[model samples]
Target chain A: MAEFVQLLVSGLATGAIYALAAMGFTLLWQTSQTINFAQGEFVMLPAFIMLSAIKLFGLPLYAAFGVSLLVSALLLGFGFKRLLVDPMIRHGVLPLVIATIALGIFLKEGVKLVYGAEALPFPEALPQGIWRFASVSVTVNDIGVLLLVFAMVLALQGFLSRTTTGRAMQAVAQNPDTARILGIDVPRMITYTFLVNAALVSVAALLITPVYLAKFDNGESIGLIAFIAAIVGGFNQIRGALVGGLLIGVIDNLSGAYISAAYREAFPLLLLIAVILFRPQGLLGRAEERRV
Target chain B: MTRWLLPAAVLAVLIALPHGLKSYGIYLLSLWAVYAMAAMGLNLTLGYAGQVSLAQAAFLGIGAYVSALLTVNGVSFWLALPLAGLVCFAVGILLGFPALRVQHHYLAFVTLGFNALVFLVLRNEEWLTGGTYGVEGIPRPSLLGLPTQSPIGFYYLSLGFLVVLSFALYALLRSPWGRAFAALRENPTRAESLGVDIRAYTLLAFAIGSGVGGLAGAFYAPLVEFIDPTPFDLGTSLALLLMVVVGGSGYFAGPFLGAALVMLLPEWLRFSESLYLLLYALLVMVLMATCPSGLLGLWAQARERLSRRRPPPPVLETRT
Candidate 1:
């Protein structure tokens, strides 16, 4: 029972990271109608940037984190407007998707070239201590990550619900033509969406770096997990990403604990495939008419 | 007369050139032929059918393993090759069932997951696949009991296969089924409304594409004399797709030209080995941005403009 509790706690912590990433992915998809395959790369770039600032520039952890988030947001905003949104404005969804894929490949290979394809340990700033309740163990970092994730989600939800820009973004996502007709600049809203999504992903990177080592290929694995989470949670829903992420985390951890660790990654993917097969709209997703 | 003679002359030169080239050149040619075959298969699905399949590598791995196992067990290479294609065809059909029902992005995601799953299986199933170490010592094919061990001999064999395969593919493209595939790509709903069974055509595309991928892998096993997971990863699959796109997916000969340039250009520029991938990525991005229609499209446009500008040949009265 203690073991189960411990696994559950750890899984939720890990799931929170996935939730953050998936939230960013969902936000980007919602506003832009373009799924940025480079979304994971956005997470990775911030982590690397933070690491470099701390190690090379001798900056403090807080400063590094701020710098990384700012840079990531700017780069993502610029990249979306220039590389993806502009050329694709006239082309359609397919070209935009393909362009993002190309951008992802470029980002991944570009990172590999700079980082030399080696996993580097991130500097641990958080205290390393654990709380034991009977057989269940909880670490300080895990608790901190969980709290941070919750705070970020709440803030994002508030922003989306309360802010005019946020509502504009949502309106753009729902109907770009309508949004445009209503005097909203759809393109600029998309750029803001990209910036916001990247900022969120950057936060995820900074928080998760302490838990896992930073690496060039780190994004690939986490990106895949986030993708699975998005699908499982229903593609467009923010709340679904959170719920689905936590559920996936628990399921993945439980499976890993009870079964072989090698099969852990397979469980979520299998679940996703099953969900798509049975409930194509996802657990919480509303059914929409298929567009020809 | 000039155009016809030029192509025939070029073909004659190509057929004889391999005999005079060095062993390394012959090897490159053979590799080109094999890749071209694989790229052609990619073209059928992605270009013609408008399906995004990133599992080309998985099918290739299947073909390689099947061929290697069969050949090691003393099965004839000729028999093993067709068996590999047939097996991949079956797997492709199986994958197509779920694939046909999903959206394009969903299909892409599924194929990506499928590729990862295949890689995992290849890495874990040690008893059969030899796991991470992979299977080696695959035998080369024997034509009429004559062993094809030398590079020169292998080159000729591969060339013959390429010629035959290309001609067969060209012929297939001209058939009614090919027209149906094109119609499906142009408008799936419209095609369905016109009595074309969408699922069947999609399955057919998947089967044919996978079969060709498998065929490429089968021949590849003999040439390389080894099978491993590295070459059949998602990277290779994406590279194949990039080749198809960069070469102009709509053109018949685009994949062939694209495959050769992509495969050979890196080797020729081996000095910057580490930066080669970055360069390739940049090139792909630039090409995709500047010329979305691809190199062939650019050439076609240029040719159109040239033909339009040039004066038509003087009218000649022929009394034949």
Candidate 2:
């Protein structure tokens, strides 16, 4: 029983990070109808930024985190508007996809050039201790991550449901033309979505860096996993992202524990293929009428 | 007469060029031929059929490993090559079933996942794939009784394959089936309404593309004399796609030119080392921005303009 509890706690902690990443991905897809292949790089860049701030500038941990989030959000928003979304307005889908992929490659190699393609230890900030109960124990960082994720989720929900801008964003996602007619600036909304999503991803990166260890290439795996989570949950659906992240987290943890660690990454991909084959609409997604 | 003259001259140059170049140049030429073949396969899928596949490398890897294993176990190169194509064809058809049902982005995602999965399998299946170390010591292909170990011998062999494949592909593209693929690309719904079997054509395109990719991989394994997971990663697949796009996807010779330039340009720029990628990225952006029609398209446009300006040949009144 205790072992199961331990697994559940760890799974939820990792799932929270995935959930945060998925939120950013879902937000981008929701507004733009394009998947940012560079989404993972957003997570990776912030962690690197935060680490640099602490190690080089001798900044306080909280200040470093704030600076990282702000810079990441600004950069992502700028790139999306200038490079991807704007060009996509005139070109076809392929160009947009290719552009994002180019951006991803550029970001990846740029980071590698700066960081020397090596993983670095993130400065320890979380309180180091564990709470034990009935042969089961949970670390303080794990608890902190879980609490932080839940708080962000609640705050996001509140913002979306109650705030006027948030409602306008949701309205735009559903029907951009109608929203535009109703006085919502659809392009600006899309840019705002990118900013908010980047902010959320940066927060996830800041919190999870201590657990995963920061690396230039880590974004590829995290972005891939977040993509799988979005697919499993159904693209463009917030609730689906949450459930999908948790489910993938549990499956990943269990598979690593029971199966060989080498096969752990394969599980999510296999699951994605199966879901795509059998349930293209995803677990929680609504089926749309096929055009052809 | 002029068209035939140019083509014949080009072919002669290609055939004789290897004799003058160094061994390294010969190796690079062979590699370019193999990549050109693979890019042509991708063209059928992405260019003609309008489907984006991120699993080209996976198919290539499958072909390489399959042929490598077969030849290393003493199977004839001729036999192993065909077998590799057949395997990839079957896998392609299987992949095509789900692929045809989804939209473009979803299909791309599935292919991306598929590539990742293939890489994972290659890295983990030590018993079969030789694991991360990869399968090495693949035997060089022999034609009839002649050994193909010498660079000169391999160069001719590669050229022969390239000529035969290109002709076959050109004929295939000019066929009714190729027209159907083009029709599907332009408008799937309209094609279906016109009694075209969209599903069947898409499946055929996938199978043929994978078969071509497999064949290229088989040749590549012998040329390089090694098969590793590195060469067949997602990056390779993306690079192939980039070649097709940069070369002008719709043209028959577009992918070949694209592949040749993309592969050879890096070699020519090897002195720059680290700056090569940054320059390449800048070049890609410039090309995409200024010449969306690609290099082949640009040439075609220029030729049309120049010909338009020239006076029509004096009407020689055939009094006789």
Candidate No. with top DockQ:
1
lDDT, candidate 1, A52-132, per-residue tens? 898899999889988888888778766656765677645444445556667776777788888878888887655678998
i-RMSD values for every candidate model:
12.0, 12.6
For residues B154-203, what per-residue lDDT tens digits would candidate 2 score against the true structure?
A: 87887789789888988898899888766777677788998898778877
Clashing pairs in 1: none
lDDT of 2 by residue, A1-292 (tens): 7777777788888888898888878887777776777777778888888888888899988899988878877788766666656765354556555566677766776777888777888866567789998699988877887888888988988888799999998887888888999999988888888888878888878877777788878888788888899888887677777777878888888888878799998898888888888888777877752221
Worst 10 residues of 1 chain B by lDDT: B311-320
Model 1, residue A213: displacement in angstroms? 1.7
Name model 2 segments beyond 4 Å from true: A289-292, B1-10, B291-293, B297-320
Tell me how many clashing residue pairs each candidate has: 0, 0
- Per-candidate DockQ versus the true complex? 0.34, 0.28
DockQ of 2: 0.28
